[model samples]
Target: MHRFANPAQFNRLADAILPWATGAFVLLLGAGLYYAFFDSPPDYQQGESVRVMYIHVPAAWMAMFTYMVMAVASFTALVWRHPLALLAGRAAAPIGAVFTALALITGMLWGKPMWGTYWVWDGRLTSVLVLLFLYLGYMALWQAIDEEEKAGRAASILALVGVVNIPIIKFSVDWWSTLHQPASVMRLDGPTIDGSMLMPLLLMAGAYQAYFAVVFLWRMKLEINRRKLAVARQVSMHAPVGAE
Candidate 1:
């Protein structure tokens, strides 16, 4: 972990992993789509609309997974002062927000056909919405503060505080009588879903994971360069007249 404290080392590592991440994302997405549409059978109850599950479930999972990543990175940044950890949290916020939003939208689309409505104040749905707000709030704190370290500190604290929400989102369906369905794929007894459906679902999930890695590495590198530029400008501004 201390070794990654050096930006140059992390940048080189990110570069090395980026190509493989991107390739995996493309291959997994292709395979997942093919399996989802052609290989997987339609839900006996939900009919063809079940197709949306391939996207919605994975997006929801990624949203929570990304938030967990941000929370852990935030903890590392706050506790160990890991430079890249702070940037990792910052880079993950927008991606998590996007995933949360995608989950919400797809859930609504899936809901309209099954539940006779496009929206609901169900436990699972509401908690997931709150997750989205948490992501937005995390990003907003960074923008609101002028000082970089202060901003990162504020964002990290918010992220740690928001950790409580993740479990609530996961258990909401079981804890309350909601329109949202309970867990099918992540059960302790091993996935309740059939093998045919499970294959594409897992594939899509793998694709989402790879996609996150590719984007995260790219964003981390961009943040590193942006910070470098900021430091250079600050030094130039404070330099003596004609000091080159």
Candidate 2:
């Protein structure tokens, strides 16, 4: 882990991985979409609307997953004082926020078809909404603070604090009476979803994960370069007027 702490090393690693991640994302997404729309059978109850689950579920999963990544990175930043860790947390925020929004929107689309309403105050729905807010708050905290270290510290604290929301989002259906469906694919015993539908779902999930990696690596590299540029500017400003 520490071997990759050096920005140059991390950047080289990222460059190596980016192409693979991008290719995987493209392949998986194509396969997932083919299976989702063309191959898989529709739900008996929900029929065509069930297709939304492919997008909604993966987005929701990524939302939580990205937050977990951010929180862990935040913990690493806070404890190890690694600039890479802090940059990682910062890089993940916007991605997580976008995924959260996609989940919410797709959930609402699915809800209207199945539940006969576009909005609900259900436990799962509400908890997911809160998760979105937490993402936004975390990003806003980063933007609100000017100093990189101070912003990283503040945002990292918020991220760690928001870690509690992940479980609540996961278990909201079981914890409270809600219209939201309970876990099917993630059961302790095994996934209950039929193999036909499961293949596409899993493919989509892989695509999402790959997409995240590609974007995250890009963002981390960008953040690192931006920080370097900022440091260069600071050094130039502080240098004697006639000195190099």
lDDT of each: 0.87, 0.87
lDDT by residue (tens digit), candidate 2, 139-160: 8899999999999999999899
- lDDT accuracy of residue 127 in candidate 1: 85
Scored against the true structure, residue 3 in model 1 reaches a CA lDDT of 39
RMSD of each: 4.0, 4.2
Clash count in backbone of candidate 2? 0
Question: Which regions in candidate 1 have their CA more than 4 angstroms from the true location?
Answer: 1-5, 168-191, 242-244
What is residue 105's positional error in candidate 2, in angstroms?
0.3
Query: RMSD, model 2, all Cα superposed?
Result: 4.2
Tens-place lDDT per residue, model 1, 1-244, is: 2333599888889889999999999999999999999999998778899889999999999999999999999999999988888999999999999999999999999888877788866666778888999999999999999988889988999999889756766576546643445532222124378899999999999999999999999889998888788778887899998987
The true-structure Cα RMSD of candidate 1 reads: 4.0
Position 12, candidate 1: lDDT = 85
Model 1 score (lDDT)? 0.87
- Candidate 2 — which residues are off by over 4 angstroms? 1-5, 165-191
**How close is every model to the real structure, measured as TM-score?**
0.89, 0.89
